[model samples]
Target chain A: MSGAKRGGIEVLSGNDMCVEGALAAGLSFFAGYPITPSSEIAESLSSILPRRGGCFVQMEDEIASLGAAIGASLTGRKSMTATSGPGYSLMQEHIGYAAMAEVPVVIINVMRGGPSTGLPTKAGQADVMQAAWGSHGDYRTAALCPSSVKECFETTVKAFEWAERFRIPVTVLPDEIIAHMRENVDTRCIAEAKPFDRLKPGKPPEEYEPYSYEISKEGAAIADFGRGYRFHVTGLAHDATGFPTNDPEEISRCNWRIIEKVEIARSAFTWTEKFMLEDAEILVFAYGSVARTAKDAVLRLRAAGIRAGLYRPVTIWPFPASEAREVFREARKVLVPELNAGQMAGEIEKYLTRGCDVEKINRLDGEIITPVQIMEAAKALHGRKKAQSSD
Target chain B: MAGRRLSPAIDIEKYLRKRNLPHIWCAGCGNGIVLGALLRAIARSGFRQDDVAMVSGIGCSSRLPGYVDFNTLHTTHGRAIAFATGIKLGRPDMHVIVVSGDGDATAIGGNHFIHACRRNIGITAIIVNNYIYGMTGGQVSPTTPKGSRATTAPFGNAERPFDICLLAAAAGANFAARTTAFHADKLEDLIFKGLGRKGFSVIEAITPCPTCFGRRNQNPTGVDLMNLIREQSCGIEPGGKSEAPAGIRLGVFADRDEKEFTEIYAEMAAGAGR
Candidate 1:
């Protein structure tokens, strides 16, 4: 571990921070493909994990990399895979398999621009919607966005904990900016952080069922692999016994449980940071690398005599819908500045009605949305709201 | 012929589900023959049923994992080797085997195939080569012979096919062999040899696909496909001179003693005083 000479925080890159987080989370296996901005993750793991009696393999492609991670997870190991945009598209089907089969695996998608091989080295938040619905069919995913190098380290460990606790795939969506940026990170504090373990069934092997949901007065429980309990897992809709079934009632029951586990655990999984929102007239909703720019824009707006604040979402998938609704009910206007062509804006519009105005400030030319652009959007929205009130 | 008659140690009937039976292969298709050989080898290896992990990617042969009773994963297309690599690395105590097709292994998964062989990880890879893509109809594959007529190659294939055994040998595999399903006993022996090898071991079983490749190539019957294998293959002795064609030689072509990848990795870690 690297540290400062004076016993303070050490300067580390976002990639190194992610490595630290994975190590702290007790990740034993890392299987991945070498894509830009994400290759450092594989490289670091290859060097560090082998020394710690852990495993690292550079898989042939992204799809297999994720599949391998799932396989490693099934055998009772904390496993993860990292990739960029095009590779993330290739991993969609297996992500669904992990969701449906309830396998605990973490996927790190360092976002880049693309519909197809668009910009490999550039940063973009275009994967926001894709992270939620990239895989086919109906299912919920736990996705986190980290703005700083420190959060990059902290959020990855959080992703592992949530995935193991819930027994589903958890995605950490960091753009190329956050993935490649270097900043001072407190490694000493992280070394003392506590990690969550997978839920283990206390019953004997014969009395246990792998996919059987035991509902107490509180909620459903997930069982850890090994320790004797055996059950079947498949890509198809399955029953509580983990056996494949096509019965409509069984399918409905299985699907709802998969969705409910995350929904019921929403309070623990959802994360957001609000700055000066109590008395703000204009609010900017942002996440990932864009959130950092939004913060600077808020400061610039405040200097320009505009009451603007930022609501940064740390978890993007559940979309922070409840918090957004609450913020919209209080603020007159909300500005969503993203790297994509209005992806997160559409998500925001879904939670707002006629009273709350949602404005989209988008850029899709493989460039980061600057603080100046967001400030301009916020100023424009504020001007329009003032004119409407005067009339 | 001199070896003892060995019965399978594991219960084959219980290990495989018969309800998924009357498999999709044509009558007398050599794939079933190859599958039998693999099951027998697994039984002979003496591994516990729960400790064996079988994985496959999409294709006709990739369906083998679904039939077996164990920790089985039916993964995405052409990625079985990669998945098996993860399993072998993550759980070194478990016996990991990958069942793949020629097109699946050499086309979409070529990079993984060569690199896995180079690493010489403790994994057994069984590739069933029927010379064409049987699942998606008779399309020309990486193992399709030059000038063979496939659905996509109506004018005969212009590209050269890869000799998988030679490729594995060049990529640093500890064990490599080629056999056809016509020689059932020989196929079983090679599979057992592969399973017993400590490093990356590859068994290329020349199988039959009568429904797609055979019907399209005008060899419509399953027996005709078997006859093709029987006529094309020749035996290669251990230390004796044998007259056999370069492409159709059957038997273990490469076997050498080397430290397996996992053990060497452990040794290096120990040397570093970890």
Candidate 2:
């Protein structure tokens, strides 16, 4: 790890980075019910936030925690809630509400092994799929993954920014490893970050349609609450006016627009790191803590004269499909290693398996995929391919 | 039930959303009467429609938010008061009202209710205690009177019901009142006082669940439920000594002025340069 200071910025752990990121994003309220791995986010906020003119509430349960956070967001304050797997499951309904109601809130899901309470203290990237589709309905959601402690801070800040700009709930999907890992993070990276504010209605209150989308040069515009702009927000499909509308035509238009807003703004939402892929014959795709192992494996493979590269996705939701396709198009084979049983691998196959050989190395036993395991997988694939060519 | 009448001068219709008609409430349900009382109080208090925010958790009574023409939030089960606390803190200018049912408020949301009371946020909570979980069938609720037969407790309820008003009083609510839907006029008066109070206030309205609690408890008609309320309730005069009735107690049990949570928070913030 780097020393306590980097480029005039103080070094910190991933959990401390989350706290710094939250503060940098101008979060004024945190309502959370603590669970393992994710509890430090709430604990840090409870101590630091009140001293910084913000409020931190330990709600009775995960459901109420998200509820209070959504309530706080509606009042024009940047609000957030943090939880692990079981708690994340409890928050799914409110997450849908925040999406439908266009409430700006950030949810940090520090994942653990689960279908339900599977492993409380262990790390797992099992929630990648859940973060995208856990909430009911056809809605556009954003989930960002941070591999290192520095990225944990930076991604949390980005989550709040995107939530405010898009007027939707954003999730910082960190697994237990990154959430609990100690690393030196430069907080000054956040100091230079620009925050996005909620879009205010341009017209008078009487003429303003709360959910009405005006395609600006930037993107879809959002109307902030308490700006005298009144409209109904329901969990049901609604028209541009935000009133519940069952009309299929209106619903289709609104639904498509919801998708379009995130789709068209993909460039701004995507984050990735490409290593030694220019002349590489093999590409390893991974994310979260698995990406960290993959990076080490790639370095080892390069030292062994086996030209291999690594592609790490920082934003897992819009699933870096296009970039993964581009990277895989030139490679002879692509390897995907994840904590879950091929969730992201399935998504990668949807986009990147045109003609290249695709392979998956999965572990569901609530243990991190070690660097040696990744290197072994790569070597096994290489030996098999070399044997086939010799035959 | 027909003999009593509220003032015709009160325009209760103004607070209603006419397009969202054909309400989900059962026919002859006293929830309509309780809704009327709340509207009357809002009208009488002279609060601007824009300045009022009604929040509710999931239940038949919690559906009150969808019917009201105000800044409303129909939230998840048992979390209305927590949501209301956020709204009150976020917009101190708005008159925040939390309408919930027994199951929604006292069961799932009981902790939030007690904490909100303990914080003493300047908000009014009107708990429509129908003594049954009406939305999800006649399930035994936290406020289901002991020995009553509910779907969950088919033989008979072994658990004692929570007296919500007493809980609020114990939790440091500045104002706490208990009334039934039959007493619409008095319900409105207490609701108005709660709305005007500077600290956390609770008005527990003993409403009728005609489809659930009523049918299961052998009171099939809404009028029969109203009669039960009338017969069981006895008045407790404000600040005067009184004796309890045979069954449920009626009227405000406690009312006092105290520093609200927001005021104290603001003062503390100001002291700390917020």
Candidate 3:
């Protein structure tokens, strides 16, 4: 199902750009249930994939959609699914299965206001924690946040690459603003983007072990069922041979490898972008659509000589702990503005060992954070931090 | 399931995984009988040892896939059909078979099962109906006969059980059949037909959970329950269950010649002018 990649400049929304990125990255199969803000990804792919001779299935629900994607990925197809918050909640079980079985899949969650279907048409950055902890177990997750329409396409391609390289589910996190926001994108950049392919077995079937935990050896290769290398795959805690085992040591080894594979590779994918943090006295830690407002607010603060800077995390999970310590060390205060009720600030607070006073600017009324609102919150939080430091 | 011995004439040990021997089934569990029928059917169908991929959901019958020596996949509870759908769609050349139970197929996975049937995908679903949730110690299931006793229904089940064959037939399965553990030979032959079909086929193998279901009801022995199933079930012509007197009719009920989904999908892709 290979076709000449689409390239050159085009005005595309973040959701449409994501589909372009997936197609450019060779996404072979997509199974998703329609949800607001993210529905465009499913709709675009449904028409695009069949034309390219790839598969696109709209399943009965998010759970089955992810289930189908995982099943297809077992056959070595780069499969993906997209959804908003409520659908994202239903996808957690299969996400955990993908992690446990080391099945590579991509899930796009268009952040919306929700504890349960709160706002379908509007945006919310509340699902940052859920992206990391929605599943029920001790497992590390890889997630990329795209603040712009252009980043949406690039990060999606990166999500596919990282998912295959790490053999885990990678999420492309964008909010309703970025998902719906239209902007000019140069697709020529994707031509240079190298989509990392899943590892194939180099040894004979007799010498191969599906979950050997050796990154450089036979363990690196994934075996397809129809291929000569036939092996069993289960979600239960399994040994290197890919069979269920109750032994504590084996369970620990199995669990540790999947975590370590993502953990050690953190520097390769975990990242953040900064604007004017050189001599800043105040820092705004933001992401997703809120980062856009934070950038404008930081620029306005600079005009007034407040020395404010923006620290936007393009990758949310694997929280860039050490980077946060270095970037915000000199700043007097860290202001976290998010659409949710301080979810991102809560995660940032855990790793602020440098003792910088962290303040939160949160909104839960289903409105995207504005630059003026951010400036007001920053000034207020900055005053509180100054008072606390002096006291 | 291994406590009882059958005649030495039938040798199906070659198809079983010797390492997983002394399986986890209780004595006289009818799942063993169903497993035998499946392996014999595979052998008779001439599918190579590596050709078939066995997928299963969670239940007593789901454990059968783990004991067999094929490209087996023990998936999440109630998602076997969904998982198999992907496998078939991913690699249309491979043969995908789903071995799930009545509760797995008709209750939790009912949506996936019917949708797969509706799409006419190339999959053979062998659903073993034990009347109750055998894995969870006799909880009332969607297929649990009304008036039957269960742990969750101590006074007798108040809910009506699903007639799964009719469900599959109505949902547009290319082939649908019903049999019991007593009809082991017939079950094997029926599986052969299901495996030979081009689209979604369902073989609802009605087995007895002697330990939980039979102990609560009148029939306590595995043999007794098998005889009851055989006596109660009536035969009918293929695609003709609607006209038969309705007391759980057996034999093939639907066999249509619709286009398989994956083939149709491939054909559509080929004509897409990419």
Alpha carbon lDDT of each predicted model: 0.81, 0.82, 0.84
Q: Give the C-alpha miss distance for residue A277 in model 1, angstroms.
A: 1.8
Q: For residues B1-274, write the lDDT of model 2, one tens digit per residue.
A: 5854676698888778877776889986777888889999999899888788888888888877777778777777787887778777777778889999999888889999998888888999999998998888899999888889999999989998898888998899999999888888889989999999999999999988778888888898888888988888887766523577347888786698999987887676666554
What's the distance in Å from true for residue B12, model 2? 4.4
The DockQ figures for the candidates are 0.37, 0.42, 0.67
User: Considering only N, C-alpha and C atoms within 3 Å, which residue pairs clash in candidate 1?
Assistant: none
**Per-residue lDDT of model 3, residues B12-110, tens digit only:** 777787766777887878788888888877877878767788899888889887788777788888999888888888888888999999889889999
Lowest summed lDDT across 10 adjacent residues in model 1 chain B is found at B3-12
Best by DockQ: 3
2 versus 3: better TM-score goes to: 3
Chain B structural similarity as TM-score, candidate 3: 0.92
Best by TM-score: 3
Cα lDDT of model 1 by residue, A269-371, tens digit: 6689999888888889888888898999999999999999998889987777777778777776899888888888887787775788878988778788899
Docking class of 3: medium
Write down the RMSD of candidate 1 (Cα, Å): 3.4
As for candidate 3, its clashing pairs are B1-B26, B239-B253
Count of backbone clashes, every candidate in sequence: 0, 1, 2
Off by over 4 Å in 1: A1-8, A115-121, A201-209, A214-260, A364-368, B1-11, B17-25, B147-149, B154-158, B236-247
Model 1's CAPRI class is acceptable
